[model samples]
Target: MIVTKNEAPANISKAIGQENVTPAWARAVTSFPPSDRILSTILTRQAERYGERILLVAGEARWTFAQTAAIAAASAQALIDAGIKPGDRVALMCSNRPEFLQVYLGCAWLGAIAVPINTALRGFQLSHIFRNSRPALLVVEAQFASAIESVEAGVELPPRTWIIGAAAGASDARLSAVALPARGAAAPAGAVRPGDTVAILYTSGTTGPAKGVCCPQAQLFWWGIYSARALGIREGDVLFTTLPLFHTNALNAFYQALLNGCTYVLESKFSASGFWAAARRHDATVGYLLGAMASMLLAQPQSAEDSTHRLRVALGGGVPPQIHGPFRERFGVPLVDGYGSTETNFVFAGRIPPDRPGTMGYLADGIEARIVDENDSALPDGEAGELVLRAGEPFAFATGYFGMPEKTVEAWRNLWFHSGDRVVRDPGGHYRFIDRMKDSIRRRGENVSSWEVEQTIQSHPAVAACAIYPLPSELGEDEVAAAILLEPGQSLDPVDVIRHCEGQIAYFAIPRYVRILSQMPLTENGKIKKGVLRDAGVTADTWDREAAGVKVRR
Candidate 1:
């Protein structure tokens, strides 16, 4: 049913604290008309509706809905002045800040594609993104200039580089460095379609370089709507997030606020000690967190301020089921577990006050999910297999992997996006996550590619062969583990293995546990038996980087 402004359901009205809030499911079935779903259009509409209401807060900087819309328009003018055109790729590498949003929103306003790169990416990983995306312009923080310089020898970076912060002494001969241009006169929003690509979010590849998930204009609109519904966001509520803006979680939090007529706050980074204080300071009613973040907060010494925050709930996906009750009891805020990826929308979410603690909530409306076997045959309920999903709303999910047609086809085979996550749906329709079916490790909320880690480890002088896999972490999620075979007659220190990986990959992707083996277990075809290594797990001889007092800093 097409719900108009006056026909909002009473339950949704109570949930959002407003009578005009549109339910996401209703928006999905109505074709998500471009005038309503496109980012530029959404911003314009919200600005007109909300007027001067505060829309975004980053540190001490604040922008109202109208101001944000103006910033986006001005940013679009700046991009156009820099020679950016519709559909051109603009690479952005920076920490969470207002400039990131300005650039992202500007891209949306101008119909350009924003490619937000993880700031921690360097060397091989960073170079691969530059080579693959081939962005027309690079907008990066001055602090990350060295990262770009590190890869300049091999990769042809964007033709122009615009530095965000102080770049006085950070200049490089190879880079065409220039100060970030001032915002130009406001430009009109572009005529963007719902299916037009808005952003290219790169997710870790299991056996290859990271693939850029092409997020369409309407997909982000759905993300804003669906995620707001999942968090039970209300009008005039303050939504705060410490997650990086480069990822989907934080970016969508902005949308959640935009669509729900709420205020959004962005922190520079996550700090377990200061989390509650910040929330209380902002008078935040809703928050966002990953599973590992919940564990980190639990590890902090309890204080009287723990339950003092106004935050009533948080979108806590991947949180360990065991800690759900305890976390709520101590913090007085319930964590809502759900299932989502860069390639998918908010597909599964638990109830507000969940009946089941650990399971990913019942499948969401406007989507179809199936547990499928190796041959793509659907499995019965209660049987664990790869979870595949299909969205009913057009352009609600990511279109495909940019520049990787083969990977796109492989992932979207049989008309369903292969999640590569093992899960089982009970008769009651609740889904429980099993394990990852693909060869990837998730550590501290970052997806670590086994292929990328193995490649980095194999580059060490004394390493002959290596297999990277996941070992269960005490703080929920996985800890990267490396099983290595030494080169003949060559001696290698386990600590050096980590030192070798220092600048080659992300700090989270570095091996936490290293086991040096004399010989690798092999298959009939001479392939290294990674499953055997994973099953062997952390052995007595495993050298733990944390236990040895080795620290890796970003």
Candidate 2:
């Protein structure tokens, strides 16, 4: 029953196409009927059909579908025994480990909500999530437990709490031991329905502040269907993920593979050097990547061993337009870029196709995506406008942000959710991302897109990384400013950087000033904190501007 690329089951594509289906772009347009089922439905199906097949791998431990389900059920019973009721939130603060999935499925099995916290968050950021989620319990690894304990002291929480892998240490005694029940009567025989809230995944805190985006179980299922088809994840597909599970990219991708009954491999942390080794070890046919991760990998010296891995697809988000062709050429794998957020799951995903540089594929089936002006009027194709998505089919649409009615209302305004990201639809109906609402520069009656500027600057050999934002000008308005990171041993002259931009970018779009930085400030999810950079003010002291050929012109 090995489900290889050539031997995929006949019903695989059909089952995935049950939703709002579009044949043109190859995707499901709508969500299926609400099911009174947990994520375990996929697990149980695997155990019944593909028995004894490995479902999960972490470190040296391997778990079959049956064993994994049993552990999940047992853990669910443990939560119920510890007074966790249905809909109660439980935060999972652990790295990429077997226990993370075990605890996540355990929560789903019991109809409780699982909030996976980013492990990279510490201090204030961690406290904000703890307070926002207000989880009744926390299932944390021993290493992060201490950080949780320190944060827990000040934050107000639910009456009960629990931590995994830690028996009882003097650090946080209030965290009681909830002994996992041994194969107890299977979760009272009920399941979390499609519309019921399943989890509260927080948004990347790049703009203002992080707000919890509510997602339901059904959304997961629908997106899982789309993802499985788009990425071609099959029953025996070995999928590897090193991205933090807290992000929607990892969570959806991981669950999509699980729903496909694919073998999943988890790494505690991502390492550029060891990535290929791990993929080869697991025989991974598919994996996940972020644009930043891809850029980092491409920066490393190439080796003959690069193309030897079994990875056929790397489904991910944020693959920059400039690097798309080069990355695919170097890696020999098609990079399928998907567009989504915590509030709305995978609205549009680029499916598996021959290498097409800089395209994020056509709009996903059943999804009604459009570019609209500030007045909410639809703009003509190729005009930059705010991206809006209407749920063409039912899947996991959020109940709304937790306790933030104003924010929720604003987000879901005009019967269309404002994505805050700008985009343009091409002649063939393909969408190209422009810049975030906050990142687009308004200068001298002209709109300058930062993405276009960054792409141009990135073409330079010494430009390793770059961020473009609006800077205050003497004209009483803001103009484009650039911050760049240089390659090792490479020195940059500001004039040369500006001159390079003049040739590639439009006159108005070219940066008025170029700032060289040791590194760009990044969010936990690796997106640049452009707002922070703007607030800090791009001053001469912050950038290394060699005084040669630099000039100020009106």
Leading candidate by TM-score: 1
lDDT, candidate 1, 1-554, per-residue tens: 11001111236435445456665434442534645688888888789988999999997789999999999999999999999999999999989989999999999999999999999997889989999999999999988988876673767888888999865334556678787888879989888899999999999999899999999998898888778777777778899999999999999889888887889999999999899999999999999989789989999998988898799899889999998999999999889888899999988887778667776886766778888899988888778889998888889899999999999999999889999999887776778899888989888889999999899999888989999989889998999999989989998888898889988898889999999888889999999888888888778999999999999866
Cα lDDT tens digits, model 2, 3-110, are: 001112234345334333332113222222346334656556546765677878887779887787777777788778877888899888777777777778788877
Worst 10 residues of 2 by lDDT: 1-10
Worst 10-residue lDDT window for candidate 1 reads 1-10
Q: Candidates' lDDT values, in order?
A: 0.86, 0.68
What RMSD, rounded to one decimal, does every model reach? 3.7, 12.1
TM-score of each: 0.95, 0.74
Residue 79, candidate 2: Cα error in Å is: 0.6
With a 3 Å backbone cut-off (N, CA, C), the pairs that clash in candidate 2 are 20-28, 20-29, 20-30, 21-29, 29-366, 219-396
Which segments of candidate 1 are over 4 A away from where they belong?
Answer: 1-35, 168-170
